[model samples]
Target: MANIKNPIIPGMAPDPSIIRVDKDYYIATSTFHWNPAVQIFHSTDLANWKLISYALTKGEVNLRGTNTPAGIWAPHLSYDKQSGKFWLAYSHMQNMAGREFNSDSFAMWSDNIQGPWSDPIYLTSIGFDPAVFHDENGKHYVSILEWETRTGYQAPGHIVIAEIDLEKGGIIGNWHRVTTGFTTRGCAEAPQVYKHNGYYYLMIASGGTGYAHGIEMGRSKNIFGPYEANPSGEPIITSSPHHLFSLGDPDSGHFEMYNPKSVMQKAGHGSLVHTTTNEWYIAHLMARPLPNTKLNPLGRETSLQKMTWTKDGWLQMIDGSNLAKMEVPGLRNSDATIQSDQLNNIDDDFNNSRYDLRFMTPYREQKSSWVNTTEHPGNLRIYGGNSFFSQVNPAIMATRATSLNYTAQTSVSFKPDHYSETAGLGLYYDSNNWIYARLCQSDKEDGTVLRLLQAKLGDRIDYIFDEVRVPNNFAEIKINYNLGTTQIMYKISENDDWKQLGDQLDVSYLSDEGVNGEPGEVGGFTAMFNFIGSVDAHQHDSFADFDYYKVINK
Candidate 1:
């Protein structure tokens, strides 16, 4: 009977972590600084999702200069069914510079959910979203958030629970803190635990992701708890519930705000699944913001609601209400075939071995000498390493302009001719903002030239086109972005027709949710990238032949 109105999984998917296995369903998200991080999806009828595979592709962790929401937070995803394995739990948020929140928590396991996975296993410096549960009797728990920088306690955050051994990485007992939620909302973090029937529940994520997020719950017979809340004490799911007290600050008793009226804004982290026919759902994490203008550009997405259970067993929402929507009934549509084009085709002729799950690379480790398929078989040879503001290293490989009216074309045949080679085509949003459209050579005018630089935030480098000679061998470069009205166009192809070398760029501040409050604020957490870079400081072996790289989405 499908038709709750669609939107089973749309853009920017955030902290969701579902799992089913018999009827097949899987989901995992959260990629803070965006590398190869964690983003996996696959569904049967939870309403179509597809994009399977990506659980971090080794760099082993070191998100070079991470910031703007800090690299990789929340990420769970379980499945034990008695050692059929599949676990994953994360948090690598290395320092938020003065926001302090240092972070480390890790764990990984796989028997197969499409993974070779199994290197990370640090598990716990504790202070970032981490969840893992196994107990039916086999035992293997982990639920974190001990982070509390001290001071009269209460709101520093606390909700521990331990008992894991996984071949001696440690954690045998004594950690239990349990209930620290429900004051109004402090910073209760992604916790998750379940048992059902006899009850054990748990499921947290309280205010403070912005606008007082929520999704609380508690219950206990034993698993280590006194737990109770949920007599409608509030937050069964939210999106502004009067703003939840506003979420965390009553001298830190928590639940700071309480303003639920709904239009979807910072809904709450969540996960819980059942459906094979048993029915039940809650995927959570929502945020639309833009109508009145809060500007959230698809970030924090992944929604679902539809729940039941309460003969007094508790667990509402099936229309009982707490916000969270986009349809949720018995659910069983998705037979596949909903392609009006799901938008994602930045065009590349690299000839796959895998590297177009919408490319992304920053903060180190993804080197085959910048890129290579044995040099040039189908074309994708980007060598000229180091230099993007070098946080450690940079060769760059982006993708994600998804839409705002688009048109990014590329075709280069560079020979930058020395003086630190440089191959072009970029739009990036980090390392302090970006915008490039290069194809250098001019060393006092002899040939090859076509520039239009700008680096902002990271500082110095603003050329805006100086040597425009067009047809310099195998040229072709286009940018075009409209984004409603930020207007930017830069074409170059001359005689074959494309002229218009530069001067239209208003760049509406390169949004995704950027350009709001600047001055050491830097584009609010990123979401604008479209690159193909190379910057060798005169090590020069120079090779750039990208016969194709399209993206057209008006």
Candidate 2:
């Protein structure tokens, strides 16, 4: 089974949401404020995948100060062959300010997709990608995205669809706008619903998510809709297949709809799946920039496409070309065998106390108080929080810089007696961009140096004459990065040779169009991260340990 390439799950794993439930497929992505939020992946070979679970681990939701693409956005995973259970639908976007994009869509369930889940059920705050469609006789709709603050109408709204009564948790009536986009590339949000053959189709995600992202469709035998579009009104999947008039644009950063011959760029938020050998795949959400640079520091990933169905049922892209393809053609005769560390390079060595569910942590909730591998059973302590320009407790742990060229080492032992403590290894992209190199506490004479700290767009530099002295706070901190440049190295033994702690630093602003939001928007859809952080702010008793994080992949 080879030929299944294009990110079958790579890096930040954006809007995805696939599902299968029989030969086991499961996808579900978008964890906008990190943490054990949404994510969930597992495959039986639609090209090997496996991050297992996290349907919002338990606190169920509350991404602290959440703002930077605003926490937990699209996570719809459905499965209910007549209440066999497993639904999930999400969105807790909580305010995007003057855009009034405030959100709160929920819905949860689980008879186990690897969950204990079953708490949220709220269902609508009016806008923000929510999906949930399980119609057949057990009826239950719930498409969403009605967010349009009428300045002229149709800027980013209207996909609506209701009739959800999950045993009486709300919405069994009004809300049915349906279709503000069938292409001319409007900012139509994620809709998703399907019924096939007798038609009830309706899939969306158009134009906005940068560079004219797409994946659009429509049909109807009346699931509520006049739904008919898609006779090549364009976009059945896209990496900018030309012709874009942008209907009321402003979902942010159309960047002139960049498609320099496509290396897979913003290929739309999709999620379709059929395969049990009847085959049909779509798992979308792509972005790869950083060469001639439109700069996407590995955020928004997860691709796969190979659809087909058109005798008059319409759902193209199986070489019919709506563009977007890095190689797709597996699972039709399936031999299944492609998981040699699925996409390699994340060598973690925290030695069994466990710490690699692809370690995420950003705006809080990794809890063990402040992260712990059972109090350093082998290493990976991390106590010190706040200060990485606090988005409330930045005790970073990060992971997901999935290659634009990688290197990322780690070795911190950290001992900062003050100067507000610090620990090392960096990259991150929130709390206003980042670079960080840190080791701290030299304020001119009390030892342990290594400094670098930067944060663009929200300002804060502090290289402090590029300090370097590290004689024993234990050093190893690396970073290579490449593509948009970044060098920052160090060494203190284990054969020593790294030493380059300065120059070469462009970091392409850590990128999601390089941070800075809310005043004309476009910054952070959650991407680049390498992390290993710490920061005491004076006696949280400091803590960093860490002895092994390695990321290799060049």
Best by TM-score: 2
For model 2, residues 1-554, the per-residue Cα lDDT tens digits are 56787787777999988989888998989888788898898888878787877888887777878878888889999998987999898888877889887888888898999989888989879888888888887889888878888788768877989888886678987988878888788888889989987889889988888878888989999988889899889998888888988898757568888889878888988989998888788999898888887878887889899899978889898888889887888886678654432375888778877788888888788888888888878788988888888887789989888778878898888878888888888888788788889888898657888889888887988888888887878888788888879888888666888889768788787888888766556777788888888989876877888878989876
Taking the tens digit of each residue's C-alpha lDDT, what string does model 1 give over 274-356? 88877788887765544444555445667778888778887878888777665566465534444222444557766764456
Candidates in order: C-alpha RMSD to true structure: 20.4, 20.2
Cα-based TM-score, every candidate? 0.35, 0.37
Model 2 clash pairs are none
| CA lDDT, candidate 2, residue 169 | 74
lDDT at 311, model 1: 87
Q: Per model, how many backbone clashes are there?
A: 27, 0
